[model samples]
Target: MLIKWSKDLEIGVPFVDADHKVLINLLNQVDDCITEQEETTVLGSVLEALVSYTEYHFTREEKLMELAGYPSIDEHKNVHQKLFHKVRAIYHSFAADRESVQVDDVRSFLQSWLTSHILVEDVKYRSTCIDKSEAAKQAGMVPFINTNGTHVPFNEWGFLRVLLVDDNPNFGKLVSTILKAVGISNIEVTQTPSEGLALMSRRPADVVLCDWVMDEMSGTQFAAKMGEMEIPSKIVMLTGYSIDTLQTKVSSPNISAYLEKPINAHNLLDTITRTAFNG
Candidate 1:
């Protein structure tokens, strides 16, 4: 299923939030078309519309940032350019030969980029650029909570180093992108646990995010090996299976936290915080 628009996604900027809703709707349309296996012409039309509107929104946003005297306008524009180029490239490739490219992959890339941008980068300008719309007020009033119903403090998780080991390359790429958007720059992504261990041996990461089931090594075994090697990295296991087994497996001291599969920004960051600060 595709992600939905929520209050936490709001950046307290009315115009930006409004543009995001339209983008979210279009994004959902794209996802639905891909999932439903719609016709090529219909998908192409929607893709073009999404790309065009995204350019327009970025331009308008840059102008507003300039007017508001945003400190990071230039840096923000650079990020916008990166997204624009990537989307345009995908559009051209997709249009040239519809069969040459996978539409589902395109949907994944789009979903990752749009949602992460709104939640990570755009929110940085909220204090300087916002209107007192009812939407803004509602966004402000809504409190962000974790799974345990505790308040989430969006603090600085950016300082820590992260090593993400997962067999699925696509999932690894998506998680890496989300981590960067959240200001966690020092990240090393490896497809196998052995490769991850080699990297960690060179320089230990603050947190190690590993998948549960892999061909070479399981997450529990990986944690045990790290403990023996004295890597000093907190293990955050990622699993899609039942936690009943995982609860007993991740009992090692190095295993800091275990997160379920279908990782999102909130849970990923929350787990990292818990391990990073010894929570």
Candidate 2:
């Protein structure tokens, strides 16, 4: 089966998108090699490359998310740990009994996992971060008259117009309510990234608060797509996963903040205010 990158899979973050492209290419290469029934030497090399690339990619992503202050970094890390262990085990099993590891098996496993992870879980975070960033920008823009009476830019208190994107309607509503409680009245809640984007297109927001995992698109993909659109919104990613692996795919300017699941109302409000108004 051929795997292709389409606009639907983009999350608008440039660096993350580039990394994902590399990963997809590497995965496809492995699949191709397996289909050819290549010799052990070639297969071994492919496996090694895949392992190395994954490690590097994961590291880059995790670090980026951490810098962005992703709250569920720990949980996301744990997922990566588990996946790495599984990959190692699979590699060993294949090395020991090459005949037992079929190309189709690997392809099936990777395709299913990657597609589900990217399209659903990853896109969630992207939406959140973009919304937050846009909110921040909106809150920060200020104009004033200069000495010559010409309108000039002035440093103004930043505020966030947050757009909370999540599949859980209750969760979205709850977040919006919390923001209002904290004096953040400009909030929008949506169940899908598409809806959030539609809203953004009409009126840009300052920031985005997104869930890391979802059913349609992963947070990362959503963020990348927003970057692709040249949106100025800052992203704050959320997840219930370990921080380790969570960091692997989340390094970008689009993601400016992060929070873990079971979000603390006080902390969340503080983070949003700080990220939005404080620049």
Candidate 3:
């Protein structure tokens, strides 16, 4: 099935929309490969590409959400972590038991997951983020080009710095890259939650993007530690899981935003831009 991009999905963030276009194209390629009855070798190559791209895309999104100070980031990051593990486990099983691997299995999984994620969870955040961004702009926190082509400098837009925290080294790098791409220069990353917390104590960032689950400390635990330490940065939890499960557990004074996994760069950027400018 062709997943057509529409205006409703535009969250006023440019880079993220571009990434989503790539993601949909890749998913379509997998579908096409399945339809062509491609050999296992070809199918495996496609699957590998899918895995690699998905990992990168998800990391980009989580980092953006973290930068935006999304309140539900932890839940979203959890979902991404779980899905990554699930996909990786399946890939490993296929490699170990080649005879049991089927093209249909891979196609079905990717199609279902991608479709649901984009249409449902992702769309939900667009309006909220847009409103927040516009509000920030109006409040003179973020500068925007007026209709006459004049630029307005907002004091709040450039004052904030951020840190991206995740256990995956690749993810941390990817996040840093995306941040720089979006005009955020003062960005730091750490693979350890402890280091992220330590950074917070020494020099509190304006915002933080943290993964939901990590080997040493979960994002929730890290956020709790920040609160205990009286760290003042706005915490945006990153997760790949359902926010419903974490809503009750996460209270105010720590988390300012929550963003789901596979976060769009546009929404993430807008969120961060707004949060920085608004704050």
lDDT of 3 by residue, 10-43 (tens): 6565555655665666566446545553233334
TM-score of 1: 0.52
Error of model 3, residue 185, in angstroms: 0.8
Native-to-model Cα distance after best TM-score fit, residue 111 in candidate 2, in Å: 1.3
Candidate 2 lDDT over residue span 1-279, tens digit each = 357887877866555565566557656655655655433433454455455545654565566555556677677677767766766666676668778876677778766655565686557557544435533343223221122332223223124478888886545645654454334667888889888877877777888888788888988888888888887888788776664567776777778778765454445655665566556
Native-referenced Cα lDDT, model 3: 0.63
The candidate, 2 or 3, that scores higher on TM-score is 3
Model 3: CA > 4 A from native = 1-158
Better of 1 and 3 by lDDT: 1
* Number of the top lDDT candidate: 1
Q: Give the C-alpha lDDT of model 1.
A: 0.73
Span of 10 residues, lowest total lDDT, candidate 1: 137-146
Taking the candidates one at a time, how many backbone clashes does each contain? 0, 79, 29
User: Residue-wise lDDT of candidate 1 within 38-95, one digit each (tens)?
Assistant: 3454455556656765775787677777767788989999999999999888867867
**Winner by TM-score between candidate 3 and candidate 1:** 1
Clashes of 1: 0
Deviation of model 2 at 90, angstroms: 2.4
